[model samples]
Target: MDNKINFKDLWAKQTSIEPNPGDLLLQISKMKRSNLRKLIVTNLMLVTVSAFIILIWIYYQPQLVSTKVGILLIILSMTIFLFAYNRSYTLFKEDINSKSNTDYLKELLAIKSKQQFMHTTMLNVYFILLSAGIGLYMYEYTSRMTIFWGIVAYGITLIWILFNWFYLRPKQIKKQQLKLDDMITKFKKLNNQLEA
Candidate 1:
C-alpha cells in the first residue's frame, strides 16, 4: 500500500480560483486613486522645492556664472520631470467602470509604455542634470574651503549621487514595474476569461 499521497495530483485536481471582474475593476480603481494621490503630492513637493531654490537664488544672488547655470539646470530638470510625470494624470480622470475590457487593456498598455519612458529616459536625464547641477553648485563653496575639505565634500556628494543612481533608482523602477505588471496581468487574465 502506498503511504504517500500524490501532492501534484491533488493540486491539479483542485479548482483554480477565478478572480471576479468586478473585484478586479474595483481594486484597479483603488490603485489608480492611490497612485493619483501620490502623483499630486510628488508634484507639489517638486514645485515647492523649485520655488525654494528660486528664492535662494534671488536672495543669495550667486556670483559665479557657473553657480547660476547650476541653479538653472536644477530647476530645468525638475520642470521637465514634472511635465513628464503629469502626463499620467489622465489615467485616473475617467471612470474605469465605463470602459470595456479591451479599452481598459489598451489604456493599461499605454500606461506601461509611458512608465517605461519615465523610468528610463526621463530618470536618466533628471539624474544627469541634477548631478551636474550639484557638482557645479558645490564648486563655489568648496573652493572657499581648505583642499582637504573640498575633496571630502565632493567625494561625499559623488558617493551619494552614485548610490541613488545605481541602487535606489533601479529598486524604485522595479517596484513600480512589478506593481503595474501585476495589474496588467490580472486584467489580461480577466479579459481572456471573458472572451473564452
Candidate 2:
C-alpha cells in the first residue's frame, strides 16, 4: 500500500487551479482601456468644438458684437476644455501597474472607480455653474434680441443638466460601484484563503 503522498499529484492539482485573479484583471483592464479611449475621444471632440466656436466668434466679429458676452462665452468654452483636459491627464497619470496580480487588480479597480466618481461630480458641478453663469449673462444682457439668445442659452443649460441627471451620472456610478463590489469579493476570497 502506497502510504506516501505523491508530489506529482499535488503539482498536477495546483497546475489545474483556476486563474481567478488573472481573469479578473484582464476583464478590468479591458474595461479601463475602453473607458480611456472614450475619454480621449470626448476630450478631442471638446477641443474641436471650442476651436470651432472661437473661429466663428472671430469670423463674425463685427455683427455679433457684444465684447463682454463674447468674452464670457469664450472663457466658458475654454473652461470646459480645461476640465476635459485635466480629466484625461489624470486618467493617463493613474495608469495601473502592480507588483502582484492581486494588487494589480485591486489598484486598477480603485483607480477606475475613483475616476468615475470624480468625473460625475465634476460634471454635475460644472453644469450647475454653467447654468448660473448663463442666467447671470442673460440678466445683464437683456434686450429684445437678448430674450431669444437668453432662452437658447438656458435651453442648452437645461439640456446639459437633464442629460447628466438622466444618463451620464447614474450610469457611471452604477458601473463603478459594480466594479468595486467585484473587487471586494475578490479581496474577501483572498483573505479567506490566507486565513485557511
RMSD of each: 8.8, 7.1
Tell me the tens digit of each residue's lDDT in model 2 across 1-196. 7869897888877656567998899999999999779777876876786677667557756333454464465458457646755764676465466346666655665665666566556556655555555445444444545667868866876788678767876786578668766776776676566456
Report, for every candidate in turn, its global Cα lDDT versus the true structure.
Answer: 0.84, 0.64
Per-residue lDDT of 1-196 in model 1, one digit per residue for the tens? 8959998998989896898999999999999899879988999999999899889889988889888888889988998888777866664565765788777776766667677677777878888899899899878888999999999999999999999899988888788778878877886787677678
- Which residue pairs overlap in candidate 2's backbone? none
Candidate 2 at 187: error in angstroms?
A: 3.8
- Weakest lDDT window of 10 consecutive positions for candidate 2: 62-71
What clash count does candidate 2 reach? 0
Query: Model 1, residue 176: what's the lDDT?
Result: 79
Q: Could you tell me how far off, in angstroms, the CA of residue 108 lies in candidate 2 after the best superposition?
A: 4.4
